[model samples]
Target: MNYLKPSETLSELFAGLVVVLTVTLAASVLGGGDEAGATTALIGAIGANTAWGIIDASLYVMNATFDRKRQLRFVHVIAASPDEATALDQIRGELDPILESVTKAGDRDQLYRSIYSTLAHGEFPARSGLQRDDIVGAIQMFCIALCATLPAAIPLLLSSHPMQALRISNFLVVGLLFIVGYYWAKYVDVNRWFAGLGLMSLGLILVGVAIALGG
Candidate 1:
């Protein structure tokens, strides 16, 4: 399975919604102009999500570019070899450790395959295949780190009642948080509800403090 599928990115994107929702709710509870607070929360959430997505996309692009360059060097050495078998074998020996290291550093399976296919005449020369579960799991983690703010953005922007809107946004955020946390717990093979709620609560508290401070 591809380690960075659209589904994976989507899951994280949903998780980001949770972050926005939770913050919006907190801001409301702290008291502020309903329309203005909601608008602020909305703006903040959208900004956060965009920033996170750009970061993830940037990492993928940068890493792929770097890996492709390295692969080119390998291809050159292998091509120049007198014996194809020996050259391929030598490259294989060197590539395995490198592949493993890249996997460990981040889920580089998809990027590597792209580079390999481009250079190897459409042949994907991946020595290892990533499990579907691993890719989904990594995406889930990435979302937990990035997407928890989607719900908050709308509330901040549209709520006429600032406090109410903020509260609504907070509740929505908490709910999304629980959803992401539950999925994350399941991915890690842990207690789902407890882990999920625990994470949601922590996020809520942090945002609550920020709202109290007029953030």
Candidate 2:
């Protein structure tokens, strides 16, 4: 499955966070019916924005490391001699587990080297390639995060009808979760309903928590 790039994933999260914070801040400035309500909204907005920003920045750094590794691999493959390429392939095979661990940590170098060495050894070389799992994970992250944001922002934006907007946004987010999850499931040949429902549940939980803490 072709999914979001690491940078793209971070960017999506960042943009959504900005939207949420902006709306929340706006609501605070406009003033709610009570001082406690306004203060609570402001605090929640600040906390959510700060937390999301940190997470987004961390993801961006990880993705950057991953891209750097891929770039290095490309360079290695292009420059290595046939014998050197063979040696690299053996080394990469030995380092496969380490590479997987590094990738999980968002450290791409080992994996990049491994993949490039493998590709260089192949009779037919690919100009560019990405693992299906990595792409799928990125897509999942983006969809899940974006879906979780709507319930928070929509309600804040419609001050006159905050509850109504919140409910509508909740439904919208669920529908989006189902669509994205279904597509992802079908792409991977999994059970579409289960995947969609699982993602929808996660979105609901996030929204519910925000609502509870927000009050």
Candidate 3:
């Protein structure tokens, strides 16, 4: 099961990388030493980011499942409506955006019937019985986050100078954040350069917060 779209994978990768770098940088600043326990810092960053990614992805899955249930309930309600016109109106209100480009009357009618039938029969026609896509998406998110940890940590693990390693990690993360933002903007039809700057600023803000809180 393919869990993540290509764009989503990139977004998660950069986000996780920024988070790991921010926290590690904050830790280095607070501890104030050239060799401020690089091994412990590396392990801590990896562990913290991995756990956070898993938790975040789990929450997303729960919310998505709840949303799916809500959509099904809405469909069931529409199907139970006494008037066909009213049911069609409800469907239009809920699904018009998705079906806007589908101009064929037969196609629209067929789609409405399919939805009504699926809801009435309690068949919930998802891709998999257990929502495999959602599960896979969560796992993909977790893996992206876990993998991001290594890049930020490798410098800390290898270098004797904590500040230098932190600086390098910060630069790498900042650059990645800009790239992530640029692509995200392009995906959403916005100004790519501005979005890149915005994301980089957001990363800086997060780093500032981490430092202020003594990470």
lDDT of 3 by residue, 1-215 (tens): 55677776776776686678767776666656456555556777788888878886897588668877877678677868877677777887788778778667678877887776666565654532248678878887888888888767777777778778877766777787788788888677889999999888887787788667765
Please tell me which predicted candidate would have the highest TM-score against the true structure. 3
Candidate 2, 95-191: lDDT as tens digits: 6566665456334545546555565665333433445455456455645455446556555466555544434443554566565556556556789
Candidate 1 C-alpha RMSD relative to the actual structure: 9.0
Q: In model 3, what lDDT does residue 112 have?
A: 81
**Tens digits of lDDT, candidate 1, 38-157:** 666667676766666656655555555566667656776655556545664655577558686546533454544444445446343453233344445455545544545545656555
Candidate numbers sorted by lDDT from highest down: 3, 1, 2
Instruction: Report lDDT (Cα) of residue 96, candidate 2.
Output: 58
Scored against the true structure, residue 93 in model 1 reaches a CA lDDT of 73
Each candidate structure's TM-score, on Cα atoms with residue i matched to residue i, is 0.52, 0.44, 0.79
> Model 2, residue 6: what's the lDDT?
48
Off by over 4 Å in 1: 1-26, 29-31, 68-150, 156-159, 201-215
Q: Which stretches of candidate 2 lie over 4 Å from their true place?
A: 1-3, 6-54, 66-151, 205-215
CA lDDT, every model vs. true structure: 0.58, 0.53, 0.74
Indicate whether candidate 1 or candidate 2 has the larger lDDT: 1
